[model samples]
Target: MKKIIILTLSFLLICFLFMQFFRPKIVNSPASADFQAPPNVKAIMIRACYDCHSNATSLRWYDQIVPVYWQVAADIKHGRESLNFSDWQKMAPADQKSKLWEIVYQISAGAMPLGSYTEVHQNAKITRDELSTLKAYVNSMAAVALPDDTAKINAADRQYSQWRKEQFLIKQVPIAPNGVRYMPDYKNWQAISTSARFDNGTMRVIFGNNIAAAAVRTHHIQPWPDGTVFAKVAWDEVEDKDGNVKTGAFKQVEFMIKDKEKYAATEGWGYARFKTPKMIPYGKNALFTTECINCHRPQKNEDFVFTQPIKH
Candidate 1:
């Protein structure tokens, strides 16, 4: 019995020693450029997300062990792929704001910093105060875009004229990079929901097709029947001195067309976006849908949708 136990211990030690050689390296290369935010907000992000989301990763001693190290490496790889603070300035200004907005969204949905990570690194867990601060900062970005009442009216009028010109000039229905066609029929669909997103300064209306409407009426929209379609149209939110809000400049329109088999890769829904009044299609390539899917991932339980339809 004593001999057997000794042999087993020896074998286990050897296995452990061999595995150490295979541990993956976590490199902390100097950042090319970093995300620019208020010092407080940046400090919070560094404490909570830098471990995996940024190039400046720091692993605890236990985290460097074989299996744990493997997982940490993988998490860092995917986390950085999603958003790397080191590469922040490389993105366009609009893209930077969008990414920050997405970060706030993921955190709000409890889909960020990853539960698995926070379990081991308690300091990485965001506090309520930190979340509140982040929200305030993001919302403040919209205020930067706001102008005086006279400028607001001028901007709206300019947008309206451009919209008319686009309607007259565009002869062909544009198609998204993902092969989803521009769905003009959504204009005839029922408005199912409306939202005023002050964080992004956009007013949005969600429209549902006959199939989606029927599913909603019957309360069968948990997964929503295949063929159910939704269109989300957005415009710049214009506010007057009295603080009343209305849709101003045309921003974009997006569609979610459902087909379990056809759109199996994208959570059983095809996504398309037409931007500006000219209806320019979004995406440089089909891979652009990856960004869309990532953004909607937190709402997967809601069939990857953010809108809740009103009772008709």
Candidate 2:
């Protein structure tokens, strides 16, 4: 029995040694650009995010070991594809801001510095103070040029009235670039949640179709059953001097249709957006769904959904 055990241990050791030679090449490059931020914010991001997110990855000795190395290599590759702070110089100004905001969202959601990563890199754990620093930095850039003039606000009000009038007219429904048709009946569905975007001066109401509504009521929402569908409609938020706020012009409506088998590539949800009263569809082609999927990645644990339904 002792001899057999020895042999088994020796075989396992040999296999582990051999696996090291088959490791995926870890590509480390000098960062072409460094993310610009205050010293505190920069330090936090470097400690928590640089491992898989930046080109200058400081891997530990244990990370260089066999099977684990393969996962780290793959993670770095996918992470860079999602957002590479090292290549920040290559991104457009608007894109840089968008990615920074996304970083804030992902971090706040506890979806970043992945659980697998933080398990090994204990120093990557973010503290509450660090989170506040990051949030404050991002909020400082939120100077949204909303419709400030009374003329423009009145025009938006007029547009809202015209939009309501158009609901009665039977017309050809617009289809998105990805083939999702405009779901007009969503207006009558159960509104499950509301989101206010102060940055854009817009308010969004999320409505769930019958299947989705049923899922919410039954608490079957962790993965949310396959047939579930949600519609999020956005409109400008008009505010009076008295601090009262109301909806202005209709801006856009987005949908998330679930089908694990069908939308397997897009995290089990088909996304579509229709903008303006004209109902002009968003996206240039089917591939535009990637943008939606990438934005939803941080909510992967919640089945790529950002909203928590208001229980019936």
Candidate 3:
């Protein structure tokens, strides 16, 4: 027993001593002068997000010690790489808007400030009110910028229409025997928003029943409540000589259902798409499902839907 005690202490001391060699280098850089916000919003951001996401990190005592320091350093590195609030003005307007959207979605999903970080800095945890303020700010900016951003995105997509059609149409998606049937009632579901994918030659209008619409409008709740279902109807785009654009041929209809246990394989959401008049099932094989999931991965925090609630 005596020998074991001494050995354990000696081993721990050696490990602690060795950890000193791996101390992460702390960097200090000036914050961007143009990154201005409302006083309250800025305060919330500084308190909740600046540590890992900005150059001006306020390192704590444990942040300077050993393994914890390594984790802190790595997180700082990754956060800065993903988004540096300190360098906000340096990014293009579209990029800035995009990052702000990410912030809103992440905070809403409780994925920011990181659980481990909030555990240590209780003040960093955002209250519902603070989240609302932040979201409001983002929405205000988005209201002015999203139309331009969407136009730009659609323009770029138009250049890739042929390629997109070829990619989606070539896949052999299967129709399950127990697949979702077309429900006439879904047409009366509350309209959520409309979007266009010029690159795919398609325009889409999304609808969700009361439960799902309420979840989207709330903006802070996540994993949308079970029983919520979203239907997105898509059609080809056609333009008249007068520059009026209208829905053309029917493309497909896609549905996303939220049922945690039922769709565990697809991250708590079940995806299905039916194409053309016959409504043949799509995503029958692994290739189809993999592609769908990959495309939605970026918006996983927002329940895997790319179409955000239309700001009024």
Candidate 4:
């Protein structure tokens, strides 16, 4: 028995030692084109996102060890594929704009600076001021004076509005006189994106209609053009025996309907929530509009929507 135990320990040590030799090569490559940002904005990004998303990764002692190094390597690999700030200018103008939008959306949704990464580097968690700075930087990119190609987003808004009104007349679902309704044909609509909110105990799938789809495809995210409508359905998440989580019970469904002329009282968008199949509207006398805007205030620049276009 003693000899067998000694052999087992020796094998384990050998395996650990072998893993060190196979560690991923951590390289600090030169930036293809140095991405420029305001001093404060650059500082925040460096502290929060650089390790995973840039070539200038600074790994800690444990980050160089075997199993942990494996995870770090994979994260950096996937992160660069998503968006490499080091190669920012190498991307086309349209791609740069799209990437900027994604950065703002992810940060606003509390999806970036990954939770696991922030667990150890607590300072990496974004504070409100830093988040605002990052968002402002992204918004500034959108405001830059580009050629007619990127500048046409404004003209496209009017065209989309006329198109949306036509669709609304033909296909808009109705609610009862008491403001109750059932879920509409959202599954058939264009899927905008999906999101999970660990802080809220829910996962959501967002859908957009023809008008919203056109606007998103055109990259006209702000001011949201009239007649745009969105449907977001959320569900409780349940963990299976394998520790994988899946959508459990139906939690709720919400809608954001945009009509600049008619819904001008609520920032040109009307909000509604249905907590059950009965589809009773959420909230009491003034609570709905007030609460909806308050919750979405952080994403005001994205036209009060948290979901961004899913880049295929």
Candidate 5:
């Protein structure tokens, strides 16, 4: 009996040790500049989809466990196989547009991130309003199909790429009062005040970043007039109570005119909300208030996006 008890304890110890060796590869892809998503869409995708779909996964401590590690790896593999935002440039224009549309459908149909995913990640659950907004955005993208001819699309892409390269070379003026600085790499950060204006049946405002612009453009919204509204976005790193470095990535600020013809008037701007995969599945909306909006209120005059311009 003594020998049997000893063997049992030894087996349990071996199992525990073996489990530690089965650590899963964590997803930690760098954010790519080549592909940009809209502020709102980007926020949602980062919180929910990035874990599996992109290289920017924010791994949690539990992900290091053995069985759980296997599950995470499998999910990430499947997610990336289905769609990878990091590789958006590699896809044809049509494919990119189509995939954006599919994202909306999947989210609306409650098929995204998988129910199993949400069971563990309460934040991944989509609210009705969020779903509606996403649907509208996706539909707008689908409405504007690239020219049917494949060669024409390729030609357009080449032209766009050249234009972007040229834009990158242009000298940038520095603007401040919002913590922007010039880097040797030609990226100019600016701190700009923001406001909103609606005029002639159109909403117009100045914004920073092509991703935000493309997100707005894809939705078929008219651009705000130049200088009508200005904003700046930045991230600050700080340590948590536990002395862990906490990063506030994807911070944003925006300003917009609430009524028509009053571009100078400031509407409320707040931090855009984002959630992690773990929080997304639990159907929690309050997380937005805590994790996102509170910090953004300081720049309420802007429409809740940090409106700093980057040189290409």
Candidate 6:
């Protein structure tokens, strides 16, 4: 018995000693000034995603154990390869948009952080509101160009034309005392509005800007031909640090455009808005719909929209 006990103790001691040498490479990336995260989004990511997907990992003391160390390293490496938060900005604009949408789909489906992960890290489990907030942010980031479906486009165009004509009538009518000017084109009239129209017959309208006249003139004023479709591409304004209001900047919002429905499982559009000085290839008003759809099929009910309805 004494001999057996001695051997057992010796084996345990040897295993512990060997574990000391099993050090996994730490995951961390240098922080950049441009990489800003909304406070809530930042919190959830740190608690759940940073361990695998980011350079900012918070390894536990037990992870130093030999066999565990191997698992930890493997998980980190796989996480980074699948989706590395550290290298997000390095990807093309379209790629960035698609990934953002995918993140939402995974979280909503409860597939993120992996079940094995949440088992050890209890806090990694996402709450209902956190999921909703994440969905909202992802949706905002993915706001993109209008769909290309002919039927939907025609309907949207008719609505836009009616809205424009109503605005014209409002402009012609006089206002009474205490009655504010009901400028139907108030959104377009805003300095940083989405009034720019592309030659392909699409209208870009910002949340608050007036460019209806400009869009009409540029697109050439005429009623839509039968079967002609019109889709509305829209966005909110981006704000600065000092609380100064800036226009034409991309603010994340839920994007449920016609093309998303038409394309269904095939594809979805993704969009993001940054500051004018950022010098992004697409400029402040750039749209990237083609690249967004490939990943959005992961969630079909929401019409490729990432904002999953929080099940009570």
Question: Which candidate should be chosen as best, given lDDT against the real structure?
Answer: 1
Which of candidates 2 and 6 reaches a greater TM-score?
A: 2
State candidate 1's TM-score.
Answer: 0.76
TM-scores of the models, in the order given? 0.76, 0.89, 0.53, 0.50, 0.42, 0.47
Clash tally, candidates in order: 0, 0, 3, 0, 39, 20
- Per-model root-mean-square deviation over C-alphas: 4.6, 2.6, 10.2, 18.9, 21.7, 17.7
- For model 6, how does the per-residue alpha-carbon lDDT over 1-312 read when each residue is reduced to its tens digit? 999999999999998897778676774768452224689887888788988888777788876567777888888987776777777677777666656666765886666777777888888899999988877776676545433445544544554465445422222433212221122333344332343222112234433222323433355213211111222233233323454322332222212223334333333332332211221223222224333443444344444433322234
Q: Please write out the lDDT profile of model 4 over residues 1-312, one tens digit for every residue.
A: 999999999999999999889877768799877567789988888889999889999998978889889999988987876667898889887666666666766786777777788998898899998888876776666532223332343434443353334332323354532243434666578888887653334568898888899998787767787878899988655554455555555556788888886777777777777664335557765446776775565466667777767546
Write down the lDDT that model 1 would get.
0.84
Error of 6 at 162 (Å): 32
Model 2 compared with the native: what TM-score? Answer: 0.89
- Across 5-51, the per-residue lDDT of candidate 1 in tens digits comes to 99999999999989989966778889988878999999998999988
Q: Cα deviation in Å at residue 31, candidate 3?
A: 2.5
Model 5 sits at a Cα RMSD from the real structure of 21.7
- Pick out the ten consecutive residues of candidate 1 with the lowest summed lDDT: 161-170
With a 3 Å backbone cut-off (N, CA, C), the pairs that clash in candidate 3 are 157-199, 173-284, 174-284
Per-residue CA lDDT of model 3 for 64-86, tens digit only, reads: 88888888898898777776778
Question: How well does model 2 score by local distance difference test?
Answer: 0.83
lDDT of 5: 0.48
lDDT of 5 by residue, 222-309 (tens): 3333333233222223233454432222222222222233322223222222122111111133233333333333223334333333
Cα distance off (Å), candidate 4, residue 175: 30
Quantify all predictions' global Cα lDDT against the true fold. 0.84, 0.83, 0.71, 0.71, 0.48, 0.51
